[model samples]
Target: MSGEQAGWALELYQRSVLKQQKFAGIQSLLGDTAGKRCLDIGADNGVVSLLLRRGGGDWSSADLAPEAVASIRSLVGGRVERIDGGPTPFADREFDLVVVVDFLEHIPDDRGFAAELGRILKPGGRLIVNVPREPRWSLVWPLRHAIGLTDQWHGHLRPGYREDSLAALLKPWFEVTAARTYCKTFSELLDTALNFGYVIKKRGQGEGGSTAKGTVVTQADWQKGGAGAMKALYPAMRAWTALDGLLPFFKGYRLIVQATRGSD
Candidate 1:
């Protein structure tokens, strides 16, 4: 790719990483966002807010970066808001749907972020979240470091929330209704690779944690995907996508949960 084309490609990739199949799943599962007050917090590019708007939700967005907010305005014709500091400047229980998307990982106090989710959501409101799962390819750290790409491995990963640990943290403020794992399942040895996942809503006072442990990919599994191996593994690739909704550990990613506010 030429210089301009390469820049364009990188832009597309960033957008893809931000708003891809995961958001699509959220949209499909949540149904028409019509008539719902939607807030896309930490909405870097406001893609999700745009999506919420396209889905007929009353959409507004907030981002910490002025450039990001400006970018959102450029794309969707203005009306995007800039969040002051790290605080969410919204009245309590103002929105019906609050999307945190990839924001949680970046926030140091993830619990405070979760509490903000609870605070902003109306009673029985829903939060749509997407976060990176544990990186199974830890063995590649050396190579990635050599290439200047491993400055901070899982730089945003919070302590005590792989799969099971996450459940404990959020359950106190929300009740998990629809919970399942979504991962990229392919390759030869490991059926799935858990890069990232999502969470949905079910109502609850948000307490209780699960003792469940999830499978993690090993270095041996990464070694199995040698040159020319990914193409050879294509046929089975479709199978993992088919099986993602059912089998959590076997997929490349971890869990996607749906939780709602508690009735109490």
Candidate 2:
């Protein structure tokens, strides 16, 4: 059973335009998992994991970081595993679906990670990946950098992946079906500004040891009227994101890629 404070991540989800857009893109592409065995790996804050569980899958979540595992535990109860950074403990072809979220770039051996993902998935199984997309040039790069969102801060080994490059990485085990990018300039910049404020506020208090760092909300953050204020303002934030539709020319920072595992 989830603790009383699982709303920590849910609160962050409500306040984050980027996370909302990412979740929307992922849900639209990921079909029903009812009665299927699903693995959600590498979730930092585990909001998606909680949502997936609610959506009715035989869901298990895991993370390589202990901080992440504890954070996930607060949301999804006993279903999450804390794994070492190597081949996972799951049996071969054990999962009908696998969703990899935001941890690929943090890995040094992404090829091996891809291989492991393939090994755990049954043939014809679906895989969903969410990542920060690499762009040729981003106008908001300086803003993000100024806010201390560098690769190290993000725990990223590399910046991120392009669709083609990421597809090639998964080529040995799966076929890519679809790719979509979101969080365009307007929304992304807004996200960055919010993160800047969050970082500032985080400095004022002792952070949760079980919680992963970098812009995620914690139980402590839920204690005040601030969350209510943000939830009430989220609609306006969503409306401001509508400006993204006006600039189709600029690629967004977030990317979701879907693939299917093969029997080999």
Q: Name the best candidate (by lDDT).
A: 2
TM-score of each: 0.62, 0.91
Query: What ranges in model 2 sit over 4 Å off?
Result: 6-11, 206-213, 224-226
lDDT of 2 by residue, 1-264 (tens): 445566567777778677778789889887988999999987776787887787798999998777677778788888788765569889999999999888788777888989999999999999999988999988887778877767666667788899999999998899999999988988987877776666566666564222332344445555544577678778988899989999987778888899999878
- Evaluated at residue 128, the lDDT of candidate 1 is 65
Q: lDDT, candidate 2, residue 181?
A: 91
TM-score of 1: 0.62
Top TM-score model: 2
Which residues of candidate 1, in runs, are more than 4 Å off? 1-19, 84-86, 135-146, 151-161, 183-249
